[model samples]
Target: MTNDRGTSSRRIFAGIAGGFLVSTVMTTPASAQDDPQHGLADIIVTAQRTEGRLQDTPVSVALLSGEELATRGISDPAALQGSLPAVQFQPVGDVLANIRGIGTFNLQPGADAAIAYNVDDIYIAHATGLTPVFFDLARIEALRGPQGTLYGRNTNAGAINIITNRPRLGRLSAAAQVQAGNYDLIATEAMLNLPLGETVAVRISGATQKHDGYMRDGHNDADIYAGRIRLLFAPDQGTELLLTGEYSNQSGLGAGGSSPCLATFAVAGCNRKGWDAYAGNETPVPDDFRSVENIGINGQLAHDFTWATLTAIASWRRVDYASLTTTGDANIPFGDFGYKPSNANQLFTGEVRLNSLASSPVQWVVGAYYSREKMTNRIDRTFLSDTLLGVSEVLDRYRATSRALFGQVTVPLGSRIRLTGGLRFTDEEKSASGVATNYFVVPAASIATGGAESHSGLTWKAGIEADLARASLAYASVSTGFKSGGVNQTPAGFGIPSSYAPERITAYQAGVKNRFLDNKLQVNAEVFYYRYTGFQELLNIFAPGYLAFYTVNSQKARVYGGEIEVVAMPSPDDRFEASLALLDTRFTRFDLTSFGGADYSGNELRNAPPVTANVAYQHRFRLGSAGELTPRIETVISDKYYTDAINSVAGQQASYTQTSASLRYLSANGGWSLTGWVRNLENEAVIYSYFGGRGYPLAPRTYGVTLRFETR
Candidate 1:
């Protein structure tokens, strides 16, 4: 299968490249410093091992600058989905990030996300610790399709790479900002850059944000708090070194819970008895507290060698978190029960690579990577009775080790064309164990399960790009991606395996990128087709007697989609941008013999939205000789999406539209800024997700203000 796919991909690549002739006419020139309305800028991305213009790189990539991100109020990964048409960001928990509608459904301790995340080339394994924190950054690159060639391991959907600003030599700068608004919200951020000596520099940044939640509590009112810090160091001319470290902590009550209505008194569309209790009847329950602590250390070293540069990176991260959740069935009248889960994870990664300068026709890079992680999780279920006694205890442990070798080369056919190819081989091993004990049961019984799995695969990519003109380019590529498989521990009756096989995807993509109107307009479009084999789908098997849910794998499938983005700048201070995506995904061959003779072929993939769109406008004005103000507005829209693959009509989210606006005041020196913003302007009753027998309500209308300062 692999060979056949490879051959077909090669043919497509050759045909696309051979059909178009490279043109040297200068089309439009776009600079990175310009706003979206001014035109599309030359997007430099690290899709390969090093930074290069996106048009010259033979891969499907999306670039979002820091200014663009700030305009949309995207401080975290979940909010970033609004910027990319081809990607979907569904928030399950702190660490759970779904990309392209494929990811881990359950936020269990041992589960892994389908889409991998990398920050400055360091892979982050835990989902809960990857939450967004605004920082000084260069650019964000979203490599679409499969990124197996460069990222390696667990990048079945794609990869999101974040690059931060490094310390500068012989420069001193500082900036600060503050904001206040509805819900008594306040936020502040500050940064300072200082050069210690002729060859040494230090950069330090920190921020703290707190907001009173939108939901009215039945008990005491609650608020959310988050904070982070980053430190960087660089010394010398021939050699450059950077070190970054950050941490975030949060504590708040879970969203409101609903009570089930009695069968005899249930109404078709009216609110149930307990549904309006918080708003009318009594004081809210005591707010639950959730806490998280994360610490990460990353270091990068680069050496200039005239013809090539040698780069090495090392990183270590640790996360500890605890949360208490209410678990009563939403529609039932059962007493409220509490489940507390605590987890700790540690990860270490190292990478070394060498890249040849673009001056050489044969620009190339080779690298090796190693990663190891250890995780532990504990869950305790307790009844909210007068005694507050514990009912059950569940413990899980996971350990994984992965290593890979990867290399890529780009050969310039001439001034107007280039060819790129890359390959990666990865080996991974994982082991997991779980124990569940029910102390409140009759005899105090306990169940134990353990499993281990190892997988190895080779992924490759090939592409060709033709520069039609300075402002326009076209490219085609074929790539592959893989996701590691692991154990499934439900109960004996579910027939779920103790382990599963790894899933793989082979993808083909073609696209065009262009800038026109003297860099005032930029447009990009791409189409992709993917064949997925041995797909690991999570099946929600409800135990007959016990109230439990189990997940397992499905079968082969296919997915195809197209994305388009346009950015136009009518004037230097006015910007407009829009993006749209359409996707068709289906399960081509699904056989469910374990449960019954059921065929799931031709079914729509779960949580996959058929259409998504976003639009935004921003204008900046000079307030006076020493001040400026910018006001921006944006909207995001999505079509109905299924929460489960069974294609059930009831388990779907209705199409919805959300709008947001922000206003900012900046000092003439650009060192300080103040901003006010509001989200979900319509107060739309959005539903983020729904499955099984319950629905997770979306965040309500929220308003906040923020202040920031910076130095360079």
Candidate 2:
């Protein structure tokens, strides 16, 4: 795709100029002067650990408000795919998020996501754990690029920070919402805030959502229930403590297996081959449950001094999760017996930090972080044939520990300029072990056990930012990101570990944020270039009597991209938001050799879309003595993308578009509201990716309605 960001500058300017002209004329008329003026609202974000205006934050971030999320029916992280221009989640099993064309591909046990998910400063350790329902949230921040300095480990791609509503003191408030949608979908959420003693307060929130499967055989049916409780205590003027606990339980049939394509040239929607054929072939595998329990406590004490304020924070968190699934054979239609796999994960993290926040020109912060994660998984395959019975089992375990020290400093040079710099040093260690056992008739059994392999690395990042004006700012930074290496679990029949190296990327970026038309419109733009070394590439190498797909650090890549966002409110009751993103990613050098070939270099990176865009519009209207109604519409579009690096001659998914819309009515007292929404209005036949030699189709069109009540 063409990088036409600069070309659109004039168009953006025209839009701002037109709004100015209209505003100038409106203020001149008496009736217009009496009419309500339309303008932008301040966007608050927690991207910097501290709450602040989004426009003032030096980091490149995309903020999605709670209202915006509701309008799009985004109850889970998977629904966030394509909602942001620079964000993409490949829907392979659970959603794997990608920021700026980089992401992890494994959802299996003992694997860590390249992107980290943090909610209220507590790290969500597992991908499945992030699948819980979301409610009573303040905002969801997508901080693009590497965020290692502040977010801790596994942030090689970026970080998603979900800020929840905090406990409110001296107040009693409650809100409830219920949603019903197509395919027998039903969802409910509630939140309550209460003040107990003079210095203590508590807030509780919960949600339950269930939906029928889109595919046949009841696969993909989702049932999730989650709740959280937060308590706050402020005994003194400068000291406070907060405690939070949360639990989520999910039970449902997992994704259906994909069928092999009988012909390579089958057209769209063809069911003769691909995932559709296997939709009904799999049965419910018992023990297919995913549950998570998390407990965390954070305390903050601030002492005011004549020069500055000394603040200290102490926190600790733990997460436990378990899940089970069934793995079927490739293509052949055998009786439903297959392998049943189960996995468990445990993670604990603690952090301490101190910062200086004074009226002076200089500000800084320093912190230390420690975290450890352990995972255990086991799989048993039972095969029953007319003449023989066989059992094969494999167990894998991994443990990772990380420690980091980080700090940042900001200095204001003058009224119109400021400088910021930050750095972090992280040390990470990982170990993996596996064992396999096989039993067959012939009065014989074989057992194979393996020891563990350990790897360690130290990584760091440095960056700078400059504020040019109250409305415009510029930042340029060099940040480093690292993804830990691990062993491949695919059986020898499929693939064996090749001792891959850690993947690294050094990114450089510059960006500008500006406001125009008297704050009626806001525009933010950023461009980034990345140099990637030891890039991990999965290649299918054909060996004697087997086909193996293994990871190899064989490629060098370059990725340059930019994103632009415009938020405008032409009238008090009308708002419009639009964003565009263009990316140019390619493998600069890729040299791989196997028994089947010598090398394949300069191939385009697989599954990397070059162009993506999103646009949304909303309007609120008053009903005089009655109430108000708000209507919203949004569209997300992406250009054609390849599913594999070779840019396969025939397996490319053409460019596609998906749209969603919502309408909500609120009571004049602001105590009640009714909302109706529809997603994938086009019912576009979109394909996100292919697995096991077949393409997996995207979710079909879905719709829902919700009612909400609140009291304060």
Each model's lDDT comes to 0.67, 0.66
Instruction: Return the lDDT, model 1, position 466.
Output: 81
lDDT by residue (tens digit), candidate 1, 490-575: 43444667777788899898887777677777667777788998777666543322333445566888887666677888788888
Candidate 1 runs further than 4 Å off: 1-40, 217-235, 254-287, 328-338, 381-393, 491-493, 595-599, 622-626, 669-671, 710-712
TM-score of 2: 0.86
Per-prediction TM-score to the true structure, in the order listed: 0.86, 0.86
For model 2, residues 297-331, the per-residue Cα lDDT tens digits are 55555555566555555555544544444434344
Error of 2 at 455 (Å): 6.0
Q: Give me the displacement of residue 497 in model 2, in angstroms.
A: 3.6
The lDDT, on a scale of 0 to 1, for candidate 1 is 0.67
Worst 10-residue stretch by lDDT in candidate 2? 27-36
**Candidate 1: Cα lDDT at 188:** 55
